[model samples]
Target: MSLSLIFELSIWITSVCGVLVALWLTWRAGKQRDLSALAGFAVMMALWCFGHLALFHGYQSLGMVLLLANPLMPTFFLHFALLFVNEGRACRPWLTAMTRHIPWIYITSIGVTLYSIWVNAGATIRLMDDRPFFVFTESGALNLGYTVLIGVLAHAVLLLGWRHHSGNKRRSILAMFGVGAWGLLLATSFVFPSFGIDVFPYPMLLLPSYLLLLVYGVVRYQILAVNRFANRALLALVMMLLVLCVIAVLGVFSGRVGLEALTNVPIWQLWLYSLVVLLMAALVYPTVRRITERLVFPGAVLNEQVLDTWSRQLNLADSWTQLVSDGEALLRRQLGQTVTIKLPNDTAPSGLHLCIEQGDIGWSAHVEKTDDLSPGMRLNLEVFGSLFASSCAALERSLALAEAERKRLDEQHLVELGSLSASMAHELRNPLNIISMAAYNAPEETRKHIKDQLARADRLVGDMLVYSGKLSLQYQRVPIKSLVSSVLTTLSTEQVSIDIQVEDTLQIDADSHRLQQVFINLIDNGLAYVRNLERGAMCVEAYLDSGRFVCRIHNNGPQLDDVLTQDELFRPFVSKRRGGNGLGLAIVKRIVDAHGGTIVHRSDCGWPVTFEVTLPPDNTEGDV
Candidate 1:
């Protein structure tokens, strides 16, 4: 009924709120830094409010005992500020040493205050309008100085850290300082009452509000990685505390003023009884919620309707690209974040990620970690990502099956074509040999022209048979340098300078005749390109690499056209050179394949054109 009682009741309710915040911080301290210190600060603040409550209720000894909590309150506050600003990074050496020694200074101040209280020299209490004022002597006044000094220092640290940092860290520190400023002003007002001042700690009424802002900071800015489930339980606790406070106020009004049947019972004891009930409710909230959740929504991470809607949206997507886009949009819309869906091979940007895996398929949904996102939201994201990955797996299987069928058809067609071409080449070679015999008997000038044309036709027919017929190897120990030199002797290399880099001792088990054809085709291909240069040059290099014999023939000429693919270059009748049959490289490829070797076109190491041949090691081997 009285204004003083109204103020007292408000302070009691908010003090309980502060204690709840301390419990929440303590719960979160394991995963976050500076939270333990903040929890200590909250506890001290709650004690400060209760101490005032005790003094007003005329419990002098208990109130003075509670006042001992004052010295460490700002100490914990400054410690939390320093840690919050540094943000888990190592602080400056001077600041570290200062933080380490600050608590001892506060402890000594407590010692001096204790001695002052023991002497009981100038400790006096006066009553005005049901509010008790404690008059402090010089020793008691020391607490006020400690409060001012440490409180300013904490804010100063916060300001400096906010100014010095950039990007997200700067923004986080700024948010902390902004929320903390309100609590700082209200907390400082409590000091006035300790100095025999008329201040009633009305700021205590907003203690619950100040604590709620910190919770908002934790959820919105990720100042702490608090558990979302715990957040829900804590909300339930706060609500119950409020309900209990309301019930206590009604009881006081009903009994003392309205009903008058229980007028003998004191109002302060009723509030105390309410406080005890609230504490018990806070302790049992988690157990109660667990029991209730099982009865309501069994085995569910979040609201089932929301999860089902997200699942439907994902399943209805027409394509993978659309699915990924829609899923990212959903996350951004619900969580208020910058979201990206990363394919398996994509590099994920730095952030919080919900990784999804279904069998061998895997990808991630990424978001900037600006908040402790709820479990319900995370479960929804996981469901979306899992569906996307599943779709990718199914699509990949379909493509693979189609590709396999296509390759089978291609191989079958090539085999039929090769048989027909081989038969044609054999029949044509017979007529070419007869023409060579007739040309030898003609007149000298006519014979020379006729023989040249006949020889060209014979070479083309021989290439066709070699490329389209079955190739058989006659494996023997062949020296690479000798084989390359023999191939060169059969070619006109007078206009080109050839460099051989094969080791003298290098030998491999391969058909010498077939290997000779491989070099002749490759080196001739290089020479045809380079011989036109003013100072033509070419290099033939061979070595053993990883149990395979490797050879590279490079020429100083213009590189191959970009439009030409390796497959196209090796196919029959796909020549880039003038007046060529084009079966030279095709025959070369067939021979290499027979010998368990591979040939590829390259332009590397400052060479304009190169053909690299790699062969599997056989019975005979020598290191280069």
Candidate 2:
């Protein structure tokens, strides 16, 4: 083939490849609005490639038609840039109307060009070495209008790049360079010729190079969200094409440099060369694939590193505060922005927020503006948020388990202390009884003092035995009202009034002696707190609730502290009263628990203080 034909054929092949790449991009554009605009730009470029092919084949009319349509290509590119910069915001009404009219304007311009061609007897058309081209004899109104249109589109693209550069520096820089370089090449190719300048083969050859740059922009800057399989496949195809091109170049070099001796080898040697090439390709494919994957999709590697680092930080964190602090730092580093985490009970900071909740723990991350964040970064943030929530949940569960274990150990210690107190009280009781008998025969005042000391010691011993669970119950049918009345009579101090509100027939199967002790302790506690009040009185009310016998002892004393819950009230050595051993409530709780009952203090029961006890019925058919 002649050199001209060879050059033309190379242009034809490059244009065909460009068209194929354009179609592939269009097919993979999917639901992204900005990507669809990019796809439209690709299609327009493909049309320009087809036009170049037509010019090479000497189809002047078809070439003119395609070339006339090619001016719209940059308009599509500008539209894509605007949409991408705005993150696919819907265009304003006037802008939408302008977009809708762009095709009609292009069509009118093409019609005007064709009319001028026919009217002037195809004076605008010319042939250089049998290849068709367009030349303007003068700067007519149509020509000036088209130039202004291209200028406006180019300026808009530059403005978009300038505005978005700070937020997405790499993509913006690539985009600006691609647009400027392509525009320069296009002006040199077509407009310079209108001024009678010869820039022939460079224009045709450089068009393919410009399209390759565009492909690079798509791959490197990620103008679209291409899936892994499609991205890898495109890379593999490009690698294969490059390998074939290299082989062809080597063959051409050999032929030109008088290396005919190598070509004159036998047919089997050619087969061996072909097999060697294939084997080399098979070996090089994976290496090229890895490099391409790293180059085109660095976000995948970044995501993995982020997750690994976050997991390590979470593991190393000893508390929730540290975990949150580390997570905030990790997010800031990975996302390339400041991040503030607002935990439960923390004051919320002002910024764009992403809230994360795990069980009872909730936190919000105040981050940079939403528009500044890329889709990949947003996805990574979501992943990190989930991981953070999970870690917080695990930490909370671990803390709760530790607290429960501590409570168990404390209860065991209290039990041992109670046992020791009971043993010591038992040994002291024999000496106390002998002193009481000896004091009865002495003077009246000494007898009264000895009796009072002996009674106080006896009460302390009874309390220790009850707390230690050493006292046994003798269950029998007992009337509730009579039991309360007898305990009040025995312990009356005349300082606080006692009110009984139990039905005379209401009966419970419980140890009478132990049951009386529970009432005495509860009443004494109420009297101690209510003695200073103007209407100092204790009310004992008994009723059945939900198939269980319930009793509520209420007093008009100071309310329980809001900070302490009912569960805390039953713990050993915890009391709100002064000069008290703190075992009265604990012993009462043990007696109720031994009888398979639940007791809870209610500060909100319309009284300052109340203790509600619910016991299973005498013949109830279940274990407590």
Which candidate ranks first by lDDT, i.e. highest? 1
lDDT for each residue of candidate 2 in 1-624, tens digit (9 for 90 to 100): 464565566567656766776676667667766567666666777776676567667687776566655446766665665555443232345445655565675575556656545543222444456556665555344643564576476456546555545545446546656656685665566565666676564455556556655655545456444445457667766766666666566565776788887656554555457657866887998789778866664443354666788888887777877887787788777766666765666676677454544343453332335575556666667677777777777787788999999999977886797778877887999999889877878899988988987887788777776787555667888899999888887874476877789999999888787788889989988888888777798889999777689999999988888888777888767887875767899888888887888899887777888999889976322222
lDDT of 1 by residue, 369-473 (tens): 536656555555666565566656655566688789999987777677678777877788788778878777789999888888887787777776677665667
Runs in model 1 lying further than 4 Å from the true structure? 31-33, 87-90, 119-128, 188-201, 214-220, 223-624
Every model's TM-score: 0.43, 0.46
After aligning candidate 1 to the native by TM-score, how far in Å is the CA of 438 from where it should be? Answer: 43
Model 2, position 112, has a per-residue lDDT of 60
Q: Report the Cα lDDT for candidate 1.
A: 0.72
- How does each model score on lDDT? 0.72, 0.69
The TM-score measured for candidate 1 stands at 0.43
Instruction: Tell me how far the alpha carbon of residue 472 in candidate 2 is from the true structure, in angstroms, after superposition.
Output: 6.5
Candidate 2 lDDT (Cα, whole model)? Answer: 0.69
| Residue pairs in collision within model 2 | none
